[model samples]
Target: MADDPFALFDAWFAEAKAAEPNDAEAMALATASADGFPSVRMVLLKGHGPDGFDFYTNAQSSKGRDLAENAHAALLFHWKSLRRQVRVEGFVILLPDEVADAYFATRGRDSQIGAWASDQSRPLDDRDLFERRFEEMKRRFEGQEVPRPPYWRGYRVVPAGIEFWTDRAHRLHERRLFTQTDSGWTEGLLYP
Candidate 1:
């Protein structure tokens, strides 16, 4: 494996994209509130590079509120087809408004409208109410370019440590961990 965790991630991600049947970029994101209450949910990886891993969400949602109180998070990516998994721990930072806007512009028209219509993590009286709100949003933006909602934005998780694991026969597994240090990343093996 490469000394650079980002390079290793890229290589594994490419393999996953080829082998996984669907949503290769899907990951489990774990966050906590100021009081230490934790939450975990699956989210799609929207962007990634040396800088960090990015995912978007509604700022007013449960995860968002958790992140607002606590900037740290952990991510887990499991590729069942490849029998591999990657775990990342990091601090989260909001992406630049322009970056979020650019990505939002690329979403489908219906998705863009849904972003404006849905009050994520909030209680809804009924499915019909949501559908009605969606219709209203669609009509409001008809014949006009849908803009990114202020509450809808991306967050980048700056990793401090990353671990890669591959399953082997008879319950054996291979594990490699890389931790960021002041000088650079330090790699080590982990018992599996």
Candidate 2:
């Protein structure tokens, strides 16, 4: 298997999916506001490449706006089944328009419509109102392809540092980290 940090990410992800019983693709995403207040939530991991780790959401959403103002973010993947975890922190960049468009177009129709219907992170008066809007969108776009809304797109985290951890008895686990620097990737072992 590839040992490059990015390639290792793929390998671990695949292993997690096979071992995890549920929501294997979900990752804890952490982003901060300009004032340094932090927010964390689970979001689906959509894409990964040499460029970075990608996920999609409305740009106007709270997390989205926070990232827009502060271009750094972190991601954590914990697989209880495998007793392993990976943590990443890095600079974020917006995915190119074409890449976002392609991924959006591939989503199921209902999912695409849900993305348009949701005014994410905004106030919701009640469940009825929210579902009404969703139903309305479903009805209006029935049998037609749902177009990706302008507000929705993708962001990729270009990792500056990544760490992998494996659990062991007595908590004396293994920890290894890779950090990008002017000289290229620098690796080190961390005491648990």
Leading candidate by TM-score: 1
lDDT of each: 0.96, 0.90
Candidate 1 lDDT by residue in tens digits, 84-187? 99999999999999999999999999999999999999999999999999999999999999999999989999999999999999878999999988988999
Off by over 4 Å in 1: none
lDDT of 1 at 126: 97
In candidate 2, what residue range of length 10 has the lowest lDDT sum?
A: 1-10
Candidate 1: lDDT of 161?
Answer: 95
Whole-model lDDT, model 1: 0.96
- What pairs collide in candidate 2? none
Q: After superposition, which runs of candidate 2 have C-alpha atoms over 4 Å from their true positions?
A: none
TM-score, candidate number 1: 0.98
In the order shown, the candidates' Cα RMSDs to the true structure are 0.9, 1.7
